[model samples]
Target: MHLIYLDEAGNSGTNLDDPHQPIHTVCGVIVKDSQWLPIETQIDALIAHLVPRVADREGFEFHNSDIFQGHGFFKGWPWPTRVDALERLLDIIVTNKLPIVWGAVDKQKHKAKYVYPAAPHDMAFLLCAERAERWFKNHAKDDVGMFIADDTKAKSDMKKSFKEYRKTIALGNRKECLEHIIDTIHFADSRETFGISFRMRLTISSSGILWAPLELSPFLSELNGMYMQEGCFRKKGAAK
Candidate 1:
């Protein structure tokens, strides 16, 4: 059996006319319940190995304000430290070949055109859920249970989205698997942070191959490129 958690980053609330900023990203992770502990241990070890000076708390203290500040601990690193951390985290998940599946969505192009049954965040959540469901279908021998950390202001919204997604799947759409039994819990920080904690015991499910949206893929790829190029480094004026 597998339990997966979903989460996103960036602003999905931006308007189409917002010239200053226009990209929203949804990031996620799927991990086996048993593997959570070993993965945390590995993450702790990695942080200790790569950044021994910062306190252990520092590793978990990522937030949007800090990342956007442009010059604190995040900006100090060559890459936005948080994004870099996320990348490193993903690398670990992939390298360990943890059963965990992960992905993201960028709303740059679909800003005004895409209209879904849920809010932007809920849409993001659905995207991750669909990705995980496909992953489990291909990799796991048994059914996979999904858990998403609630970020919605209204809990009912999340539930509604899940229900709608289930309907879509039941209809044999095959476009994406949005409908799956999902449980949501509220956690501090984004769900991806929690997903990152469980790195060692991760296992990929066996249901089907999970592929990201073709349209959103380019934006996510670009964000990753930016993180690698300049976002990872510590900026001149970020939070301390």
Candidate 2:
């Protein structure tokens, strides 16, 4: 089975007024069961490389906000050092050829466009889930897929949304069934799950690309290679 580990960034629930987080993004990294261990090992090694002095690396979490802002475990690290660490993490995904599936929503636009807009978290989850189902159907036809999201304050609401998605066609011009994805989404603590941590970094980096493209273009260019283009649920005539 393929496991799609998930994480999100810029989540403000139903409140679309947060100026700092004008968009909400949900990202998932697809890794086959057989490939998960190798990815986890590389992530562990990177953590060791980041903090060699710590004897037990079990608690080290790869949070992009902290890593980017030089906070938490990444505090006191130089800018170049932090950037290098993030790049190295990205390298693991590149080397593994993992397929990244993500969904992002511009809060203001979505709110204005709908009579009663779905919360950004809900909309992003559906989009991400749609592509994840597409991935299993197109790329891994013989295998089933599972979803695991990092535990967040939006867990209860997201769980409700997930159930509805599994039961009906998503709101779109075409039918988007999430049947290929088996079971309910398992919510795990990011600090304990390497895959979730990997996902956390990806979501943040992707959100950065959306909101601050000029500053994150280099990372964006590097990340483009990992997206599952064929699995993307783009509208007709949408730019690739």
Candidate 3:
């Protein structure tokens, strides 16, 4: 059996009037039944390495809860530290060869259209759904289920959108098709929320990795080019 949990990092909407910055990312991780404990242990070790004293002081053991809370140590740290932590988390995901998926949406396109922009949360969920579909298609032999944290209200909204999306894809009222998709889709608030009877274990990764490489290289380069050419963010009274 396969279990996948969804999480996201980064803000979707930046200061609107600022033209120089416009990128939103959605990241996801997928794991099989056997990998849950090893992944969790690795994450705990990484956190301890990053901030041993914080864990010792608080007597708060790391669990699924800490992923969304910034894990306590990263709250007000400098940008460099935050970036480093994000990189380390990404390294863990890549090292494990876990299924990681992400999408970077161009903010300028929505702004130009002047429509109510899709929230970052919505985009993240859509990305998750897309990745889940891909995984399902690729692994025909496996029984797949989705377990997502109650990290944000966006997740609940995404569940609704995903149902609609499935309907569109199924395109008919056949019971067999609906049952097939329903068997594949399962939502849980957290690992604990779902009993351990399910064969699969759980894994978590930072969502920030979705944007790190892109922001560090090509995406930033393109943005810089646009800024240099038009002086967009530097314009008099411009907002960022």
Candidate 4:
């Protein structure tokens, strides 16, 4: 069995047209349940290793956005120092040999199509979850996995979208992917959990893949062909 940490980056909410955040990324960090303890311990010990906040608070959360934006515990840190800490975190992920599956959408490109079951973020979640399900089923038939995500205030719609997928997966009309995931997802507050804080340790790879929609990025023309060949990376109903 495995426990997968699921989260997203570059969320534009309902504004897929937002110029700044043209992309929405969803990541699944798949770790064997057996090794979760040691991996969590190693990452938690580093909370005090990097730049720390001096306020009278109990502690701080390690968020990718806050670190990149020089806020919270990452505030007042030199650029290189922050970069180094992030690299060290990535090293932890690589050293552990974690397998990650991710999906991202160039929102602007997708928005142009103007057809989808839900918003971009919800769509991204469903699409990404399907890939994770495929990975588990494809590898070992007996393997099972559950999802844990950072608890966010506005996740009702996303939850509904996932439920819809699971509800209809057996109808044959929804063959784009199947849902072998555990029935309900678990959530943790990032402020209280090391796993959620490190959930996106593998976003860099997904970002590289979803940097720009294939249609708009001339450089990724051939790479887009490879994605089509794989088929699972495509949006629902898009695979031929």
**Index of the highest-TM-score prediction:** 2
Expressed as tens digits, the lDDT of each residue in 56-123 for candidate 4 is 33666767666667887678877667666665665666677666777677776677766762477876
Better of 1 and 3 by TM-score: 1
Residue 100's lDDT within candidate 2 is: 84
CA lDDT scores, all candidates in order: 0.48, 0.75, 0.45, 0.64
Please tell me which predicted candidate would have the highest lDDT against the true structure.
Answer: 2
lDDT tens readout by residue for model 2, 1-240: 888999887888789878877878888888899998888888878888888877756578778888778898788989888778877887787788778888888888888898999789888888888878877777887888888988777678777788889876546568776778888888888888778777643333323353321333344444545463322223334454
Q: TM-score of predicted model 1? A: 0.57
Candidate 4 wrong stretches, greater than 4 Å: 51-57, 115-117, 168-179, 201-240
lDDT of 1 by residue, 100-188 (tens): 33333334445546664224555555565665676656656366576655255655665666666765643135565443445544344
Query: For model 2, which pairs clash?
Result: none
Give the Cα RMSD of candidate 1: 9.8
Better of 3 and 4 by TM-score: 4
Query: Could you tell me every candidate's TM-score relative to the true structure?
Result: 0.57, 0.85, 0.54, 0.75
Q: Enumerate clash totals for all models, in the order shown.
A: 40, 0, 1, 0
What is the TM-score (0 to 1) of candidate 4?
Answer: 0.75
- The candidate with the higher TM-score, 1 or 4, is 4
Candidate 2: residue 16 Cα off by (Å): 1.4
Q: Identify the runs in model 3 with alpha carbons over 4 angstroms from their true place.
A: 9-21, 53-72, 75-87, 111-124, 169-240
Superposition error at 120 for model 4 (Å): 0.5
| Candidate 3, 1-240: lDDT as tens digits | 555555444343444343433455454456666877787777667767767776353433223223324555445656566556554554555566566444544556645665776664455455556555655665533565564443454555666766765554431352212212343234454434322211111221232221223212222223223111222213323332
Candidate 3 weakest ten by summed lDDT:
196-205
